[model samples]
Target: MSGSDGSGPAGRDHPFDAAVALKPADTGDGTYTGATHPAYANMVGPYGGITAATLLEAVQCHPERLGVPVSLTVNYAGPVADGEFTVSARPSRTNRSTQHWSLELTQDGRVITTATAVYAARRDTWADTEATMPDVPEPEAVPVTPMPDEVQWAKNYEMRFLDGALPALEGAPESPDSTTMLWVRDAPARPLDFPALASLCDVFYPRVFLRRGQAMPAGTISLTVYFHADEAVLADHGTRPVLARARSNRFGRSYFDQSACLWGTGGELLATTHQLVYFKG
Candidate 1:
C-alpha cells in the first residue's frame, strides 16, 4: 500500500530525498516529471523551499547541465497541487566559466512555478567572509524545540532557536524586531548538499507571524540564494547542523522582504538568501 508520504509502505526514502523526488521519463522533448511529496507538505501546499530545491534539482539533473550551481532564484506563480507535475529545464547560455539555465514546473497545463539558475566552474581565488557567525551556544548545547503539527515540514528537521521565537497568542506583546538565529539540519542526519541546503534556507517560519504574535496567511513569492561554498566544503561538514540568521527589513502593503545567511560550524559561510513574502493581515 502507498503511504501519504509518497512512498510505499515501509517507507525507506530519507525525508530530504522524498521531499525532492523527481523522475525522468521519456519526454521526447527532454523534460522531466516530478511530484510533490507529503513529507514536505505545508498547510496548503508543498513547502516553498522544497519546491525551489526541486526546480534546482531539475537543472542539476539535466544532461546538458554545466558546472555547479552558484545561484538560484525561484518564483511561485501559483499553488502546486499534491500530484504529478512536469519540469522543463534548458540551458539558456554557456560560457567558459559560467552557465545559465531557465526552468518551469507545470501542472495540468498551467504554469505554477518558474526558476533561473547560474552555475560556475570553480577555480582557486582569494576568498574572505565578512559576515561573522552569531556568538551563541553550540547546537549540542541547545535543546530541540517541540514541533507543532500544523506545520508538517517542521518535523523533517531539528531546530533549536537561540534568539527569536513565535510569541504566545494569548497575551504576549509584539516582538521587538523580526530577527532570528537557529541551528538546523535534517532530522535523520542526511548529508548536506545543494538541494538540502536550498530547502533549509526557507525553513524559517514567516517573520510576520513571529513578530506580531498572530497567525496570518503568509507565503513566499520569490526566493533567491547565492552559494558561497563548493561541494567539497559542504561535504566536509557532513550532516552537521548549520547556523542560520534571518531578518526582515520591511513589512508593508501586504509584502515583506527577508535576508538570511547560513554558516557552517567551523565559521564557514555556506550561502546567503533573500526572499519577498506575501501576507494578509
Candidate 2:
C-alpha cells in the first residue's frame, strides 16, 4: 500500500498505503504525499522515506543502489494517521564515497515528516575482511512465527523468532532492561540487492530492543546501520537467520538511545545499528 486518503475515489488498494502521492514533474520541486491508516502507522515504519530512497536511487549516477541503508534520520513533525501517504525527494549532493538525498513525506497539503539518507558509492569495503559465519540454529528448523498485531509492515520480511518474541507484545519484562534475538531475512521470495537489504535491515526499529516495565515505550526515532560484510550466511531461500540482538542505553521522557547487532548464522557480525528514540508511555 502507498499513502493516500481513506476514500476510494479512484484507483486504490491497501488503505494505509494511500496517503503517499508523488509529483513526477521533477520540478526540481518533486513531492510525494500519502494517506494514513491507524493500523499502518503502528505496523509500518516510514514507507515514504523508503519510497523516496527508492526514487532517489533511480536518478543517482549509481544504477539502482537499493541495498544497505547506511543511515536514516527521520523527524516526526506531526501525527500520521493511516490513509494515503506521499513522498518526494531530490539529490541534495553527489560524490564518489557517498550520495545524499533530501526527502519528505506529506499528506494532502500538509507535511507528515522529512527524511535524509546516505549510501555507499563504491564496492563495499567491509566484505574484504574474512571471517567464519555463526553456528546458530538452522533457520527453517526453528519454528515459524506468525506476524504480530495487525501490523502490516511486519509482513515485509520473513522472521523467525529465536527467543523473547511471543511475550514482547504484552510489554517488556518488569525489570529495567532486557534483550531479545531474532533470525530475520527480508524479501525472501524475491531476490534483493544490497541497498534494499540494508534498508530493510534498519527498518525494524522501536520494537527491535527488549525493555522492562510499562512505564514508557522507548523506540527509535533515528537509526544507523553499518554493514560490515555481504557474505551470505544462508544459501537456501527456504530459511535463513540473522541474529538480531537489542539493548538500551540512556532512558528519558522525550528520548533515549539503544544499540542492536545483526549477525550471520556463523556468528559473524554482519551489521551494527544505533538508534535514538522518543521514550514515553
Candidate 3:
C-alpha cells in the first residue's frame, strides 16, 4: 500500500508500495482485491516478486492474522493476466505460538497462484547464523548495474553486482557455476518490512542467464522464503541496502533449483529462500 498510511518511507512515493497495495473485498469472505501496477509489470506478467509480496500482504492485513510471517511458499500455477485479482488468505490451523495459512490468487474465475504461510509469535531466544555475508566492497564502492529497460520490475530496485551478472543475450562464455552476489534495495529507498523482504528474496536474475551466458526461457515454478529477522531487526535496518547472494544447485533437462540468502548490513541473516525454476533452451 502507499506509504501515505505511514507504512513506507516518509515523503517519497514508491512504486513498490503501490504495487503491493491491497484492499479488503466486500464479499465478506475474508478476501482481498488488488490491481496490478504497471511499474512492476514483467515481460509476460507482473513480476514474480511483486506477486509474492502481494500474497504476503494479503496475510499480513488479515484481521485474524496471528503474528508476523516466518515462512511463506508460493506456487505459480499459471500466468497471471494483467488486471484486477482477488486473494484469499485463510487460517488453516492455529497453535499457542504459531499459525498456518492457506492463500490463493484468482483472476476472473481461474486460480493464478497458490501459497501457504506460517506466522509465529516469536520469543527471545538464543540464535546464531551459520551463513555469513560474503566479503564484498561497500555499496558505494560498487557501481550500479544497469538493468534492461524492457523489464519494468527491474527499475524498482537499485542493484550493484559484485559477481555473476547476466551474460550476453547471444553468444558468451559459459560460467562454471551460477552464483550471483549483489547489493539491492528499493530504488527510491523504502523502509524494510515483511513485504519488501519477501520481494527482495526474488531480485536475482534467472540462474540460467548466468550459467549459460545467454538469456533463455525461464520462470520460477515455486518459491519458498524463510524469514529469520523480526520486526525489531527490520526497523533497525530501515532504508539501507542489503547484501544478496544466490546460487543454483542443479540444472536438469527442464528444471533447476535456486537457493539464496539475504543479509543485513551487519551480516545478520535476514532471510533464506529456495525456488524451483522451469527453463527451455
Candidate 4:
C-alpha cells in the first residue's frame, strides 16, 4: 500500500538520504568532477548514478545490525563523471517491515539518473529455508590476486571464485547468458554497516558479469537484493569462500539483467539478488 509523492518521495522515516550532482565540464582531460556530485566520491569507478540499494543502504546497510534488502532499482540515463554532481534520496513508502525510496543524479542542471529501492527487517521464517553454501577454499590458502583495472574497489577485500570463467571445471558449465560466483571480504575487518555491506555488491555491477567467455563491466540501471534469512550469521562463518551465484535475464546495448547471491561457505543460504543495468557510451 506504499507509494511515491508527486514531486519526489517524501521521507516518512530515516535520515540517510544524500544529494549529489555534476559540475561544468572540465577541459583538464575531459573527465567528470565530484564538486558537482559529492555523493559520487569514488573517482575511480563508473559510479553510475547511485543505485537504489545505496539509498536503502544509507538507511539500512549498517554492520552489527539487523536489516535486509527486498528490492533496488536504478534508472541511469546519464553519467556522473569525475566532476562534481548532486544526488538526493527520499522515502516513498514504509510499512511495518518494508521501506521504499527514490533518488536522482544530476550534472550541470541536467538530470541523468534516477532510482528506487526497498528494505525490510530480516524475518524469522527465512531461517528455516534450506539453501546451502557449497564448500570452498580458504582465503589464506589462495594466493593474493590483483584487482581488475575496472574493479579497483576489489583491493579492499579478499576474494575467491567458486565458479569463475575457467574453461573447464566439474559441474561448472558455460552459458551465453551472464553469471558468476565469488567470495569477498574487506581486509582488517571494516564496520559491516549497510553502506559497507552494500559496497560488496557495488563491486559486482552488471558489467562484471561473465559466463563462459562472457565477461564485461555491468552498470546496472536497477538492482534488487533479497536477504535469504541467515545473512546475520555471516560473522559466525569464517573468511572462507562463501557461495555466490549470479545471472542475467537480458543483455543489450542500452539495457541488461543481473543478479547475485551470498552464502556461508558451509552451504548455508544467506542472500540473493537481481538487478537491471543501463550502460554508457
Task: Kindly give the number of clashing pairs for every candidate.
Answer: 0, 61, 0, 45
Tens digits of lDDT, candidate 1, 178-225: 998899998877888898889989988899987887778999999999
Candidate of highest lDDT: 3
Give each model's whole-structure lDDT.
0.87, 0.51, 0.90, 0.50
Which regions of candidate 4 are displaced past 4 Å? 1-54, 60-69, 121-123, 149-151, 165-179, 205-218, 229-242, 249-255, 278-281
The digit string of per-residue lDDT tens for model 4 on 54-166 reads 44443342222224555555565655565545555556676777766665656777876666666677555533545455565765565545455444344455666555533
Q: After superposition, how far is residue 122 of candidate 1 from its true place, in Å?
A: 1.5
Best by TM-score: 3
Estimate the Cα RMSD of every predicted model relative to the unseen true structure: 4.0, 7.0, 2.2, 11.0
lDDT of 3 by residue, 48-71 (tens): 989999999998888888979999
Write out the backbone clash pairs for model 1: none
TM-score of each candidate structure, all chains considered together: 0.94, 0.65, 0.95, 0.62
Q: Rank the candidates by TM-score, best first.
A: 3, 1, 2, 4
Q: What is residue 130's positional error in candidate 4, in angstroms?
A: 4.3
lDDT for model 4, on a 0 to 1 scale? 0.50
Question: Alpha carbon lDDT of residue 101, candidate 2?
Answer: 67
The positional error of residue 276 in candidate 3, measured at the CA in angstroms, is 0.3
Positional deviation of residue 16's Cα in model 4 after best superposition, in angstroms = 16
